[model samples]
Target: MMNLILHGYWRSSCSWRVRIVLNFKGLSAEYVPVHLVRGGGEQYYAEQRRINPMAQVPTLVVDGRSISQSVAIMEFLEETFPEPAMLPRDPYQRAKVRQLVEIVNSGIQPLQNLSVLKRLNSEGWDSDRVQSWAADWIRKGLLAYQDEMDSVGAQYSAGDSITLADAALVPQLVNARRFNVEFEGLSRLVEVETRLMNHPAFASTRPELQPDMEK
Candidate 1:
């Protein structure tokens, strides 16, 4: 029985991405809540910084070895528990899945994360302005995602099967809604998200259902 612990925040999209993979893979991890906003963000504390030098949520500690970043954690889970593979076996399909994952991970999430928003606030960006900024970037990224998906023309992000791309996309959609990003032009993403949300892995791991979720 390898010990697994997940340190994360309820509302973090990155954390949600990892949670989806963990649940989909039927892997259990003892969850430790790290409230990102309370107490000036607990992630900045020495304890969390030791586990993740980046002080980000969704740090997976497996047998005492810590791994940070949601994509890395998902990849680790996929590799370790390959029974329910999150990636396709075909090389081109795998690359396509990775490409979609990066659309959210690199292209969108970094711009709208809590730390970046907080930094914007410090620089005198009001809530409305910050949210507008976040929404614009999210829309840009998702539009690109949609363009890629249109080319693929599958049920999910990368393909018909639930790949790493679906895990990444669902959470970013949650954030997009939070920032009031309009979905009028993103019907494909909405349709895919609706389908994915019905799956047990996604439904069970939603932020609102988490023990640490705050209203």
Candidate 2:
């Protein structure tokens, strides 16, 4: 029996990230879906909120411990499992991968996360406000990616093979597209996204393929 319980939303990019890492690491775990929109989300429910005070989906309950934040979950898994490595072994190379993940997780994802959107709406903001928030991050993030990728980007973020960095990037790009963030000028990152999308690991774990995705 798997001892891990992953509380996640079907369309959440962070949830997708953790799912890919679990798959890549050959770990078996139970998936518990948290509806992020229904009844104002099960994440906010008393029982679920006790699991994570942040009231966010993608909270991993592992070894009788509650873990939140996707990046932390990924790093914890890497340290705990440490085989079929998602990050490079070299210190500098791993730093590069970490940098990429941070850009997406902290710099990009937070600005466009659902909680923030809900807060915005509660404050009387409209769809345009939400779109603007998403656009600002995705556009600037793509530009940053383009500049960085100009020299170091090979077939992937750090090299010719898949890494945790790629794991982080692909999901957020899905959000960017879902939010209609324009990427016509940032061709390199777009190309990278396309490449990652074709990779079976990412392609198969997407929200669209999930059992609980709403219509």
Candidate 3:
């Protein structure tokens, strides 16, 4: 029996975060695709809702307990399987990783999530307008990221090693592209994104390659 079961959508950045972590840790899961769009989002359906009241993807069920939220799930995985150590051992360095992670998780992602965009669409925003809204917020948050990277830059988001921040960043960059967010002058970010996207841990988890994807 598979010990870990992940409930996620192919294109969801939050779900992508967990997927990258799973791959980085050299772990495998029974991937249960919860289509976020079909049938008005399978996440809202009673079955998935029973696992995650928030009706969100990236829910990991392990040892008869369900864990929601991608960051929370990553933390759980870090504690249980700490060999590769997605976080640093030093408390301060770990906090730095979390800091960059939050800039993506709370700062950027919420502004353009499926629910928020759906609300905007229902409020009579056209596709272009909705894209503009997403692009605007993503640009602002990524600007902050760029500034931080310029200050204490490294091969990855936090430092020389691949930390939780890098996991958060690559997915957000994908979202930026999906919404056509222009991040001109953010060369450091662009470089890091390009390198990670091609890395095996990141490449194989792309939305297009997922089992649930149609194209």
lDDT of each: 0.92, 0.84, 0.89
CA shift of 69, model 1, Å: 0.7
Q: Which candidate is the best by TM-score?
A: 1
Tell me which of candidates 2 and 3 scores higher on TM-score. 3
My TM-score estimates for the predictions, one after another, are 0.97, 0.92, 0.95
* Model 3, residue 198: C-alpha shift (Å): 3.5
Cα lDDT tens digits, model 2, 102-134, are 888888888888888878888998989878888
Instruction: Assess candidate 2 and give its lDDT.
Output: 0.84
Stronger candidate by lDDT (2 vs 3): 3
lDDT of 1 by residue, 74-184 (tens): 998999899798899999889988999999999999999888999999999999999999999999999999998735557888777899999999999999999999888
lDDT accuracy of residue 89 in candidate 2: 90
Name the weakest run of 10 consecutive residues (lDDT summed) in model 3.
Answer: 146-155
Rank by TM-score (best first): 1, 3, 2
Query: Which candidate order results from sorting by lDDT in descending order?
Result: 1, 3, 2
Q: Candidate 2 regions off by >4 Å?
A: 150-153
Q: At residue 56, what lDDT does model 1 achieve?
A: 88
- lDDT tens readout by residue for model 3, 1-215: 43999999988999999999999999999899999989989999998999999999989999768999999999988898997988989998888888889999999999999999999999999989999999999999999987776245577777777888889999999899999998787778988888787788889888888999876
Off by over 4 Å in 1: 150-153
